[model samples]
Target: MNETIRALLSKLGGLPMPVADLADDADLYAAGLSSFASVQLMLGIEEAFDIEFPDNLLNRKSFASVAAIEKTVAIIVDGRKVA
Candidate 1:
């Protein structure tokens, strides 16, 4: 899941630096993730993971870093499994 999120971030993050150069807990916004790019990243993640991000997860903190995105996706995916 971390690899998938990193791959998606690499493709959609539009960051100035390589996604691989970032730490899992690095601040993506500080690494040059614009608001628009974050939206694109979110959409790509949704498609890649086949999960819709609930409205509650649509916030800066949810996409703040690779780790944050991983956690958010896990919650949604795990909830789906239980349902």
Candidate 2:
């Protein structure tokens, strides 16, 4: 999952540095993730994970960092399993 997230970031993050070089807790916005890029990243995430983010999760906090994104995806994926 982490690798996948990193791959998505590498492809869509538009960061000045490589996503693989950033720490899990690194602030993506600070690393140059613009709002447009975040939206693109979100789309990539949805496609890659096969999960649509809930409306409640559509916010800056949910995409704050790699760890945050991982947590959000885990929640959605786990919820799907229970349903």
Candidate 3:
């Protein structure tokens, strides 16, 4: 899941530095993630994970870093199984 998130970030993050070169906790916004790009990234995540991000998880903090995104996706995916 982390690897897939990183791949999606690399393709969609729009950061000045490569996503692979970034640490898991690196601030994606500081690395050049624009608001528009974040939306695109979210869309890509939804497609890749096949899970819709609940409205509650759509926020700056949820997409703040690779770890955050990974955690958020895991929560959503896990919730889907119990539904």
Show where candidate 2 strays beyond 4 Å: none
- Model 3 reaches what TM-score against the true structure? 0.96
lDDT of 3 by residue, 1-83 (tens): 99999998889888888888899999999999999999999999999989998899999999999999999998998899999
Q: Tell me which residue pairs clash in candidate 3.
A: none
lDDT (Cα, tens digit) per residue for candidate 1, span 1-83 = 99999998988888889999999999999999999999999999999999999999999999999999999999999999999
Position 31, candidate 2: lDDT: 90
**What's the lDDT of the predicted structure labeled candidate 3?**
0.93
Best by lDDT: 1
Model 1 regions lying over 4 Å from their true place: none
